[model samples]
Target: MALTLALAVNELGTNSVKYGALSNDVGTVEITWSLRPGAEGRGRELVWTWVERGGPPVSPPSRRGFGRFLIERVLAADFEGTVKLEYASAGLVCALVAPAPEDRAS
Candidate 1:
Protein backbone atom coordinates (compact mmCIF):
# COMPACT_ATOMS: atom_id res chain seq x y z
CA MET A 1 0.00 0.00 0.00
CA ALA A 2 2.86 2.36 0.77
CA LEU A 3 4.49 1.59 -2.52
CA THR A 4 1.20 1.96 -4.31
CA LEU A 5 0.64 5.47 -2.98
CA ALA A 6 4.24 6.48 -3.51
CA LEU A 7 4.29 5.41 -7.12
CA ALA A 8 0.92 6.98 -7.73
CA VAL A 9 2.16 10.28 -6.34
CA ASN A 10 5.33 10.01 -8.35
CA GLU A 11 3.45 9.36 -11.56
CA LEU A 12 1.14 12.27 -10.88
CA GLY A 13 4.08 14.54 -10.14
CA THR A 14 5.72 13.59 -13.41
CA ASN A 15 2.44 13.97 -15.23
CA SER A 16 1.98 17.39 -13.66
CA VAL A 17 5.21 18.44 -15.22
CA LYS A 18 4.20 16.93 -18.52
CA TYR A 19 0.57 17.98 -18.73
CA GLY A 20 -0.54 20.23 -15.87
CA ALA A 21 0.31 23.49 -14.14
CA LEU A 22 3.82 22.36 -13.35
CA SER A 23 4.66 22.83 -17.00
CA ASN A 24 5.35 26.49 -16.36
CA ASP A 25 7.80 28.24 -14.06
CA VAL A 26 4.90 29.69 -12.14
CA GLY A 27 3.52 26.25 -11.26
CA THR A 28 3.90 24.35 -8.02
CA VAL A 29 3.35 20.74 -7.06
CA GLU A 30 2.39 19.83 -3.52
CA ILE A 31 2.70 16.25 -2.32
CA THR A 32 1.57 15.37 1.16
CA TRP A 33 0.54 12.36 3.25
CA SER A 34 -0.65 11.76 6.76
CA LEU A 35 -1.76 9.00 9.07
CA ARG A 36 -4.99 9.96 10.73
CA PRO A 37 -6.81 8.32 13.59
CA GLY A 38 -9.60 6.18 12.34
CA ALA A 39 -13.13 6.04 13.71
CA GLU A 40 -13.16 5.70 17.48
CA GLY A 41 -9.41 5.59 17.53
CA ARG A 42 -9.23 2.38 15.60
CA GLY A 43 -6.65 1.51 12.98
CA ARG A 44 -4.99 4.37 11.18
CA GLU A 45 -5.79 5.50 7.70
CA LEU A 46 -3.30 6.90 5.24
CA VAL A 47 -4.18 9.82 3.03
CA TRP A 48 -2.17 11.40 0.26
CA THR A 49 -2.75 14.35 -2.00
CA TRP A 50 -0.82 15.72 -4.95
CA VAL A 51 -1.54 19.16 -6.29
CA GLU A 52 0.08 21.07 -9.12
CA ARG A 53 -0.43 24.53 -10.47
CA GLY A 54 0.38 26.73 -13.49
CA GLY A 55 0.44 24.42 -16.52
CA PRO A 56 -1.71 23.78 -19.53
CA PRO A 57 -5.17 22.38 -18.97
CA VAL A 58 -5.62 18.64 -19.45
CA SER A 59 -8.04 15.85 -19.99
CA PRO A 60 -7.22 12.49 -18.49
CA PRO A 61 -4.80 10.62 -20.64
CA SER A 62 -6.87 8.79 -23.24
CA ARG A 63 -4.52 5.86 -23.37
CA ARG A 64 -3.57 4.12 -20.15
CA GLY A 65 0.19 3.94 -20.20
CA PHE A 66 1.75 1.17 -18.10
CA GLY A 67 2.81 3.43 -15.24
CA ARG A 68 -0.44 5.34 -15.02
CA PHE A 69 -2.65 2.30 -15.30
CA LEU A 70 -0.49 0.33 -12.93
CA ILE A 71 -0.72 3.00 -10.26
CA GLU A 72 -4.50 3.16 -10.46
CA ARG A 73 -4.91 -0.59 -10.57
CA VAL A 74 -2.59 -1.17 -7.66
CA LEU A 75 -4.39 1.37 -5.48
CA ALA A 76 -7.65 -0.37 -6.21
CA ALA A 77 -6.54 -3.97 -5.80
CA ASP A 78 -4.31 -3.72 -2.77
CA PHE A 79 -5.79 -0.92 -0.69
CA GLU A 80 -9.34 -0.58 -1.91
CA GLY A 81 -8.59 3.10 -2.40
CA THR A 82 -9.75 5.47 -5.07
CA VAL A 83 -7.93 8.23 -6.93
CA LYS A 84 -9.79 11.51 -7.12
CA LEU A 85 -9.22 14.21 -9.72
CA GLU A 86 -9.89 17.84 -9.00
CA TYR A 87 -9.36 20.80 -11.27
CA ALA A 88 -9.00 24.12 -9.53
CA SER A 89 -8.03 27.69 -10.28
CA ALA A 90 -4.45 26.86 -9.46
CA GLY A 91 -4.22 23.55 -11.35
CA LEU A 92 -4.94 19.85 -10.86
CA VAL A 93 -5.03 17.62 -7.82
CA CYS A 94 -5.17 13.92 -7.03
CA ALA A 95 -6.12 12.65 -3.63
CA LEU A 96 -5.99 9.09 -2.30
CA VAL A 97 -6.86 7.37 0.94
CA ALA A 98 -6.72 3.81 2.23
CA PRO A 99 -6.66 1.72 5.36
CA ALA A 100 -3.18 0.85 6.47
CA PRO A 101 -2.22 -1.95 8.78
CA GLU A 102 0.23 -1.23 11.53
CA ASP A 103 3.86 -1.49 10.52
CA ARG A 104 5.70 -4.38 12.12
CA ALA A 105 9.15 -3.42 11.02
CA SER A 106 11.47 -3.22 13.99
Candidate 2:
Protein backbone atom coordinates (compact mmCIF):
# COMPACT_ATOMS: atom_id res chain seq x y z
CA MET A 1 0.00 0.00 0.00
CA ALA A 2 2.82 2.34 0.89
CA LEU A 3 4.51 1.55 -2.38
CA THR A 4 1.33 2.15 -4.27
CA LEU A 5 0.86 5.50 -2.62
CA ALA A 6 4.44 6.46 -3.26
CA LEU A 7 4.22 5.59 -6.91
CA ALA A 8 0.95 7.49 -7.25
CA VAL A 9 2.46 10.55 -5.65
CA ASN A 10 5.54 10.31 -7.81
CA GLU A 11 3.43 10.14 -10.93
CA LEU A 12 1.43 13.15 -9.86
CA GLY A 13 4.59 15.10 -9.21
CA THR A 14 6.01 14.12 -12.55
CA ASN A 15 2.86 15.10 -14.37
CA SER A 16 2.69 18.40 -12.57
CA VAL A 17 6.27 19.17 -13.47
CA LYS A 18 5.84 18.20 -17.07
CA TYR A 19 2.45 19.64 -17.98
CA GLY A 20 0.20 20.38 -15.02
CA ALA A 21 0.09 23.02 -12.30
CA LEU A 22 3.76 22.82 -11.35
CA SER A 23 4.81 23.38 -14.93
CA ASN A 24 4.76 27.13 -14.46
CA ASP A 25 5.86 29.59 -11.81
CA VAL A 26 2.49 30.63 -10.41
CA GLY A 27 0.81 27.29 -9.81
CA THR A 28 0.58 25.12 -6.72
CA VAL A 29 -0.49 21.67 -5.65
CA GLU A 30 -2.17 20.85 -2.37
CA ILE A 31 -2.44 17.30 -1.10
CA THR A 32 -4.35 16.28 1.97
CA TRP A 33 -5.77 13.11 3.46
CA SER A 34 -8.05 11.94 6.23
CA LEU A 35 -8.93 8.64 7.87
CA ARG A 36 -12.41 7.51 8.81
CA PRO A 37 -13.98 4.38 10.13
CA GLY A 38 -14.62 1.87 7.41
CA ALA A 39 -17.97 0.49 6.35
CA GLU A 40 -19.37 -2.71 7.80
CA GLY A 41 -16.69 -4.61 9.77
CA ARG A 42 -13.75 -3.25 7.83
CA GLY A 43 -10.96 -1.25 9.41
CA ARG A 44 -10.10 2.36 8.61
CA GLU A 45 -10.54 4.04 5.25
CA LEU A 46 -8.37 6.75 3.74
CA VAL A 47 -9.64 9.67 1.72
CA TRP A 48 -6.97 11.62 -0.13
CA THR A 49 -7.43 14.76 -2.16
CA TRP A 50 -5.02 16.36 -4.58
CA VAL A 51 -5.87 19.82 -5.77
CA GLU A 52 -3.86 21.89 -8.20
CA ARG A 53 -4.42 25.58 -8.70
CA GLY A 54 -3.15 28.71 -10.51
CA GLY A 55 -1.91 26.81 -13.50
CA PRO A 56 -2.89 26.72 -17.14
CA PRO A 57 -6.53 26.10 -17.96
CA VAL A 58 -7.31 22.47 -17.38
CA SER A 59 -9.06 20.07 -19.72
CA PRO A 60 -9.84 16.38 -19.65
CA PRO A 61 -7.30 14.24 -21.44
CA SER A 62 -8.27 12.86 -24.80
CA ARG A 63 -6.73 9.54 -23.85
CA ARG A 64 -5.86 7.93 -20.55
CA GLY A 65 -2.19 7.96 -19.61
CA PHE A 66 -0.32 5.39 -17.58
CA GLY A 67 -0.28 7.66 -14.56
CA ARG A 68 -4.00 8.14 -14.76
CA PHE A 69 -4.40 4.43 -15.22
CA LEU A 70 -2.37 3.75 -12.11
CA ILE A 71 -4.21 6.21 -9.94
CA GLU A 72 -7.68 5.52 -11.21
CA ARG A 73 -7.60 1.85 -12.07
CA VAL A 74 -4.70 0.04 -10.43
CA LEU A 75 -5.05 1.62 -7.03
CA ALA A 76 -8.81 1.28 -7.08
CA ALA A 77 -8.54 -2.41 -7.88
CA ASP A 78 -5.81 -3.03 -5.35
CA PHE A 79 -7.50 -1.18 -2.54
CA GLU A 80 -11.05 -2.11 -3.43
CA GLY A 81 -12.07 1.50 -3.54
CA THR A 82 -12.94 4.36 -5.85
CA VAL A 83 -10.87 7.06 -7.52
CA LYS A 84 -12.04 10.26 -9.15
CA LEU A 85 -10.13 12.58 -11.44
CA GLU A 86 -11.47 15.99 -12.24
CA TYR A 87 -10.13 18.52 -14.69
CA ALA A 88 -11.55 21.82 -13.70
CA SER A 89 -10.85 25.07 -15.51
CA ALA A 90 -8.67 26.12 -12.60
CA GLY A 91 -6.69 22.94 -12.41
CA LEU A 92 -6.78 19.19 -11.95
CA VAL A 93 -8.22 17.49 -8.89
CA CYS A 94 -8.02 13.90 -7.77
CA ALA A 95 -9.85 12.17 -4.97
CA LEU A 96 -8.73 8.74 -3.91
CA VAL A 97 -10.62 6.52 -1.50
CA ALA A 98 -9.04 3.33 -0.21
CA PRO A 99 -8.99 0.95 2.71
CA ALA A 100 -6.37 1.90 5.25
CA PRO A 101 -4.34 -0.38 7.40
CA GLU A 102 -5.56 -1.07 10.90
CA ASP A 103 -4.09 1.00 13.68
CA ARG A 104 -1.02 -0.60 15.12
CA ALA A 105 -0.78 -1.91 18.68
CA SER A 106 0.62 0.78 20.87
Candidate 3:
Protein backbone atom coordinates (compact mmCIF):
# COMPACT_ATOMS: atom_id res chain seq x y z
CA MET A 1 0.00 0.00 0.00
CA ALA A 2 2.77 2.39 0.83
CA LEU A 3 4.55 1.64 -2.40
CA THR A 4 1.34 2.08 -4.34
CA LEU A 5 0.73 5.47 -2.75
CA ALA A 6 4.33 6.51 -3.27
CA LEU A 7 4.23 5.63 -6.94
CA ALA A 8 0.88 7.29 -7.40
CA VAL A 9 1.97 10.53 -5.80
CA ASN A 10 5.26 10.37 -7.65
CA GLU A 11 3.45 10.12 -10.95
CA LEU A 12 1.31 13.11 -10.14
CA GLY A 13 4.30 15.15 -9.06
CA THR A 14 6.14 14.17 -12.16
CA ASN A 15 3.27 15.21 -14.36
CA SER A 16 2.90 18.48 -12.54
CA VAL A 17 6.58 19.20 -12.94
CA LYS A 18 6.45 18.37 -16.62
CA TYR A 19 3.07 19.65 -17.80
CA GLY A 20 0.59 20.59 -15.14
CA ALA A 21 0.17 23.16 -12.38
CA LEU A 22 3.63 22.85 -10.95
CA SER A 23 5.14 23.53 -14.33
CA ASN A 24 4.55 27.27 -14.03
CA ASP A 25 5.79 29.73 -11.49
CA VAL A 26 2.39 30.64 -10.08
CA GLY A 27 0.81 27.19 -10.05
CA THR A 28 0.53 25.00 -7.00
CA VAL A 29 -0.61 21.57 -5.86
CA GLU A 30 -2.36 20.77 -2.60
CA ILE A 31 -2.97 17.35 -1.16
CA THR A 32 -5.18 16.61 1.79
CA TRP A 33 -6.36 13.43 3.44
CA SER A 34 -8.55 12.33 6.29
CA LEU A 35 -9.63 9.19 8.07
CA ARG A 36 -13.16 8.97 9.31
CA PRO A 37 -15.48 6.38 10.71
CA GLY A 38 -17.25 4.37 8.08
CA ALA A 39 -20.94 4.48 7.38
CA GLU A 40 -23.20 2.64 9.82
CA GLY A 41 -20.51 2.39 12.43
CA ARG A 42 -18.17 0.23 10.47
CA GLY A 43 -14.42 0.64 10.70
CA ARG A 44 -12.95 3.61 8.86
CA GLU A 45 -12.63 5.21 5.51
CA LEU A 46 -9.71 7.09 4.05
CA VAL A 47 -10.43 10.04 1.86
CA TRP A 48 -7.76 11.93 -0.04
CA THR A 49 -7.88 14.85 -2.36
CA TRP A 50 -5.33 16.31 -4.73
CA VAL A 51 -6.01 19.74 -6.11
CA GLU A 52 -4.02 21.82 -8.53
CA ARG A 53 -4.39 25.53 -9.06
CA GLY A 54 -3.00 28.49 -11.04
CA GLY A 55 -1.74 26.36 -13.89
CA PRO A 56 -2.74 26.09 -17.51
CA PRO A 57 -6.33 25.34 -18.48
CA VAL A 58 -7.41 21.86 -17.61
CA SER A 59 -8.82 19.31 -20.01
CA PRO A 60 -9.62 15.65 -19.96
CA PRO A 61 -7.00 13.39 -21.39
CA SER A 62 -7.60 12.05 -24.87
CA ARG A 63 -6.01 8.79 -23.82
CA ARG A 64 -5.46 7.09 -20.48
CA GLY A 65 -1.79 6.92 -19.63
CA PHE A 66 0.07 4.63 -17.25
CA GLY A 67 -0.06 7.22 -14.50
CA ARG A 68 -3.78 7.54 -14.91
CA PHE A 69 -4.13 3.80 -14.83
CA LEU A 70 -2.10 3.54 -11.64
CA ILE A 71 -3.92 6.33 -9.87
CA GLU A 72 -7.44 5.50 -11.01
CA ARG A 73 -7.41 1.75 -11.37
CA VAL A 74 -4.51 0.14 -9.55
CA LEU A 75 -4.87 2.16 -6.37
CA ALA A 76 -8.61 1.72 -6.40
CA ALA A 77 -8.23 -2.02 -6.76
CA ASP A 78 -5.56 -2.21 -4.09
CA PHE A 79 -7.64 -0.36 -1.55
CA GLU A 80 -11.03 -1.50 -2.77
CA GLY A 81 -11.78 2.15 -3.21
CA THR A 82 -13.05 4.70 -5.67
CA VAL A 83 -11.04 7.29 -7.59
CA LYS A 84 -12.38 10.41 -9.25
CA LEU A 85 -10.51 12.62 -11.68
CA GLU A 86 -11.91 15.99 -12.63
CA TYR A 87 -10.58 18.51 -15.09
CA ALA A 88 -11.75 21.91 -14.05
CA SER A 89 -10.90 24.99 -16.06
CA ALA A 90 -8.52 26.08 -13.36
CA GLY A 91 -6.69 22.80 -12.84
CA LEU A 92 -6.92 19.07 -12.27
CA VAL A 93 -8.56 17.61 -9.17
CA CYS A 94 -8.47 14.04 -7.99
CA ALA A 95 -10.24 12.40 -5.11
CA LEU A 96 -9.65 8.94 -3.72
CA VAL A 97 -11.77 7.11 -1.17
CA ALA A 98 -11.00 3.75 0.25
CA PRO A 99 -11.75 1.46 3.11
CA ALA A 100 -9.17 1.49 5.88
CA PRO A 101 -7.33 -1.70 6.71
CA GLU A 102 -9.50 -2.39 9.71
CA ASP A 103 -12.58 -1.86 7.63
CA ARG A 104 -11.30 -4.35 5.12
CA ALA A 105 -10.61 -6.87 7.81
CA SER A 106 -14.15 -6.50 9.02
Candidate models: Cα lDDT each: 0.70, 0.85, 0.90
Report the candidate with higher TM-score, 1 versus 2. Answer: 2
Best by lDDT: 3
Of candidates 2 and 1, the better by lDDT: 2
Residue 87, model 1, lDDT = 64
Best by TM-score: 3
TM-score of every prediction relative to native: 0.71, 0.85, 0.92
lDDT of 1 by residue, 1-106 (tens): 6687667777777777777877788878878889887656657777777777667765666677876676667765677656666666567777776665563121
Which residue pairs of candidate 3 clash? none
Question: Any runs in candidate 2 off by more than 4 Å, and if so which?
Answer: 39-43, 103-106
Cα error, residue 45 of model 2, in Å, equals 2.1
For candidate 2, write residues 7-91 as lDDT tens digits. 8889988988887899999999999999988778577888899999988988888998898899998877766788999999999
lDDT for 94 (candidate 2): 88
Worst 10 residues of 2 by lDDT: 97-106
Query: Whose TM-score is higher: candidate 2's or candidate 3's?
Result: 3
Flag the better candidate by lDDT, 1 or 3: 3
